[model samples]
Target: MPDATASILLLGATGQVGHELRCTLAPLGAVHTPGRAAVDLRVPDAIRRAVDEIGPDLIVNAAAYTDVDGAEDAPRRAAAINAEAPRVLAEAAQTTGAWLVHYSTDYVFDGTKRAPYTEDDAPNPINVYSRTKRDGEAAIQAVGGRHVILRTSWMYSRRRSNFVRTMLRLADDTDRLTVVDDQLGVPTWAGWLAEATTTICNSLLGAEGASKAGCYHLAGTGQTSWYGFARAVFAQFGRTDVAVEPVSSDAYDTAAPRPAYTVLDSSRARAAFDLPATTWTAQLDRFCERIGTEKGTPKAPFASV
Candidate 1:
């Protein structure tokens, strides 16, 4: 499957998933991660120039404005980075003969469906952030090039400022917590996504790479509500001191209305690339184990909250 030594341009190298990707994508090719000064995603001209200058065979875009509630206040900035930037990259990829690998969110769906959302489902973004991400997906598809759009849900890392970290911090500071129980989604480990992405990049260099270009639901297998996830996090981390109480989402007055359900069906991706599937709980357990070893937290079996 060695077509040629690929020159890869990886965007958003500092982000959670991006950081994991930086490690996993290293073996595939020469990865060049440009800083904001080198390539400003806010400016389309800067993005185009970066693509033109690097002339990469593969571009993995992990940069995104992920502040869901803050997006309501700064829609323009979100649109610039999440919406227009992808369109420019897709066009540049088409011109440079590079395969663009982009990450989107399962929030594109309204979350009303009881089952996992498939690639064919129409996007019904209910918030500004999700709208911008959904728009980005549409723009990339419209550009019509060798690209793969992977949509994941509830992605978290041991190092990032995510739910797992938040829960740990809360347990350290307080003994009681109120978490939303209505909303449902699958929590995906960042390392798993990075591994999947590397596999996809290798496939891209293979003969079947072009055929796999399109939208695919790439995410965790099992699903759980935010409340359940919080419980599991505290349980696995041996934070028995914290008493997490489940509450309705209506208890909080958030700017964005989170979808009630957003589980993603990653069956297509697994079948297409021969990827293995793992449950969110298993991923979380692995993550907790790492946290215990690295962060000096106590690790235990899955305990009920």
Candidate 2:
């Protein structure tokens, strides 16, 4: 639906991925990122009013309630943001004849399949957070508008509550870290995900992408367990000062039940968009290089750590 002078309405500008998206989407069109006060998703009326007012050719929704364990305690809030909100957005997109791009989670799968999960794999969400995401995907598809729902896993950034940042914090605060090795996924950098989304946005402006509209897996190329990912992070930084230990998922008493494996196969998105195949470890190298160049750390400066 995007033309040369396309108008883009991006939700969740404050988020890790959304923050990167604000700059990445600028070259494509005029990107409008309204704060929560203006586009409060919980208030459906506010969402419709914002969508109607903006009238964007492309609506990229990077926003969603992402607190996995927290969702166990507050399912209603999570559903409001993850399920009902996306449904309303899809309705608005259908009304305005705009293309909607929404993000989903790998947790939608029960993680029973040890192999990489494909797009066709049926979702059997085991937790409240994952269930809401699955509901959101269903609502969008039910609308039958031009949309692409990307299911990704293990998203991280320098400024977020993700595994990467958590490991960095642990590396600074302590030398001994015990991470779960049973749960497997691809640790995708938020910036890279933003760039990939930008590429998809460009392609979606054409005929080919329209035909490929559907749910697709778009995470990192390779996969590893949480313990392996953490070890890789430390290894990238050459953190000999720290020691990492691998344990089972049962080691931690989490509010939500974690799937044993949720690694997504991005082959569908790759074949559709002609995206390059890059591994998670290679991306980790790039991430570490970026952080090494930056001045400060999460708590104690990296220079000292």
Best by lDDT: 1
Taking every candidate in turn, the Cα RMSD to the unseen true structure, in Å, is 3.6, 2.8
* TM-score of model number 1: 0.95
Candidate 1, residue 107: lDDT: 94
C-alpha-based local distance difference test score of model 2:
0.87
Flag clash pairs in model 1.
none
Question: On residues 90-158, what C-alpha lDDT tens digit does candidate 1 reach at each position?
Answer: 999999999999999999999889988999889999999999999999999999999999999898886
What TM-score, computed on C-alpha atoms, does each candidate reach?
Answer: 0.95, 0.94
Worst 10 residues of 2 by lDDT: 294-303
